[model samples]
Target: MASQPIKSDGGSSSYYLIPNGARDLLDLIEHKRMEFGIGNIFKACYRLGEKDGTSKRYDLNKIIFFAQRELARLPKDA
Candidate 1:
């Protein structure tokens, strides 16, 4: 799910809300980061249903870190 990324006022964090189908991606990333003590930053990922205005939520620090990790792992050739 595509989402609008948000940043922190302190300039040290960020956040994004992905749709329900994307929850698995969040879970997978969280699992990978757990051993490194990085999961603490994630508050939770929730879907309020189609009737609700929004369907996803992410903590600033967690999402920001995840995004950085993804960027770092991108193939140099790509």
Candidate 2:
């Protein structure tokens, strides 16, 4: 919605901007009881496709990296 300003207050970044109806990253993290690369993936998604100093490409790259890490950490069938 771009209604809230970017506030870096303390631990939770609940004030970060997102689409009006979109699910918040904090909600996802809490619901998922996130462990390992999930948090980083959420972090990257939180700011993805925004004009926050870093471009959307940067966030995409971060998401890709975190996803790759998570995928790698999972058990693989032989």
Candidate 3:
């Protein structure tokens, strides 16, 4: 399934999808550090329980995927 924009709850989807429109969001997504997945992870977490039916499940799954990516990107202790 395709990922929904952060503003999917209300405002026009176009606003968020536009690179120059939602600058902060795009910046977070484009960040290339150890915390690259932070934006998506937090967005997914915020969506949890906020929506009904499939949307809720989608958010949960999204969180899991981002979390895994985050964990893999982090250094593990021996």
Candidate 2 scores a C-alpha RMSD against the true structure in Å of 13.1
RMSD of each: 12.8, 13.1, 11.2
Backbone clash pairs for candidate 1 read: 14-60
Q: Assess candidate 3 and give its lDDT.
A: 0.62
Q: lDDT per residue, candidate 2, 1-78, as tens digits?
A: 124466675776754434355477766566546775778777877777774588889988888888888788878961
Estimate candidate 1's alpha-carbon lDDT, on a 0 to 1 scale. Answer: 0.46
User: After TM-score superposition, what is the CA distance of residue 23 in candidate 3 from its true location, in Å?
Assistant: 14
Off by over 4 Å in 1: 1-58
Which portions of model 2 show Cα errors greater than 4 Å? 1-24
What is each predicted model's overall lDDT from 0 to 1? Answer: 0.46, 0.70, 0.62
Residue pair clashes in candidate 3? none
Shift of residue 1 alpha carbon in model 1, Å: 13
Candidate 3 on 1-78: residue-level lDDT in tens? Answer: 134435466756654343454455446455422254677776567567676564777888888898888778768971
Residue-wise C-alpha lDDT for candidate 1, range 1-78, written one tens digit per residue: 114545568655523443345556457455444433234333333222222443334344455676577567769884
Model 3, which residues run further than 4 Å from truth?
1-34, 49-54
Give the TM-score ranking, best first: 2, 3, 1
TM-score of each: 0.27, 0.55, 0.46
Ten-residue segment with the worst summed lDDT in candidate 1? 42-51
Instruction: Please give the range of 10 consecutive residues that has the lowest summed lDDT in model 2.
Output: 13-22
